[model samples]
Target: DAAKEAIYARLKKSEAGAGAMHFPLDRDAQYFEQLTAERIRTRYVKGFPQRFWWKPDGRRNEALDCRVYAYAALHGLLSMGLNLNKRVEALPPVPASRQSRNDPRPVTAPMTASPRRRRMAISSNYI
Candidate 1:
């Protein structure tokens, strides 16, 4: 319950555009629906009220599950001393001369290594 609450709070913050996370701009209505498919519910069990997450029948909650799993993965990485903010800050800045006049966003150079090599390097860090 605690973990779920924390994840939900982060999600709320992201939805409100007040967090470090943001959903992709291309997500459709169905995606949003699935992302919020579950709700917290309380039921009496053995004369005690137990609060838990619940979703109605026929509702697909894969999006919500994926979000929770992503949050857990981020926490796991942080526990391993992987500082995401520091990593981002360490990225080489894009030169003003390389920026396109039409595009406002600064473009960074692409990785020189192959995708497989990059994957292997990342996996080896935690191995």
Candidate 2:
């Protein structure tokens, strides 16, 4: 939620910068809220630059989401690549060899794939 708020601030500033690129206000508040939300998500989940639909010109723009850009510019370089399964991944593989006085063995388990039903659950809940 905090990041989302920050995204809102970024979007607001961006909207001002965009001038004519902002999403149309005619749709209603709910639509704006929805658009704001997606913008925030795109920042972290997909890297940077959120999407917006401008009503004045009825065009979609991929304006640079400065908030995300700043975040990624600072943090992305340091992070190891994220594994896709890690999002809901259970754990790492267990050790297959070696032993220790304390019965040394890897305890982490690999992630389980989401069942089809559960897989679809995300888009519905979050979107």
Candidate 3:
């Protein structure tokens, strides 16, 4: 409950232009829909209240899940004593030569790793 509240608060603040977080200008309607697919619901179980985010059937919520995971990751980083603001400030500006032509941002090499193959068990019934 607390975590969900915190996430909503941050999102609200950002939407109100009072937060450092910003969304891309190219986000589509479907993206926004997925981002807000879930709603908070409370139910009583054994006289105890249980709160959870609920989504209707056939609704996709990958965006919301990604946001939650991102918030958790940021919380984890802060708990580890990493000053993200300071780290951002300490970074040097990108040189014009290093900047991409299409986007005014520095280009970084794509991360690549060999895919790991997993072993699967076969049942005699299937065979």
Query: TM per model?
Result: 0.69, 0.20, 0.65
lDDT of every predicted structure (CA atoms): 0.78, 0.47, 0.71
Candidate 1: count of backbone clashes, pairs at least 3 residues apart or interchain: 0
In the range 46-106, model 2's lDDT, one tens digit per residue, is 6767644233344332233444465565456447665545543555443555334355334
Estimate, for each residue in 1-127, the C-alpha lDDT of model 1 and write its tens digit.
5656776777676345545456556799998889888899999999999999999999998988888888788889799888767767777876777567565554554545799999998999998
**Candidates ranked, most accurate by lDDT first:** 1, 3, 2
Error of 1 at 61 (Å): 0.6
Count clashes in each candidate, considering only residues at least 3 apart in sequence or on different chains.
Answer: 0, 1, 0
Q: Give the Å shift of residue 77 in candidate 2.
A: 7.0
Which candidate number has the best lDDT?
A: 1
- Model 1's alpha-carbon lDDT is 0.78
- Model 3's C-alpha root-mean-square deviation from the true structure amounts to 7.8
Candidate 2 regions exceeding 4 Å error are 14-31, 37-78, 81-127
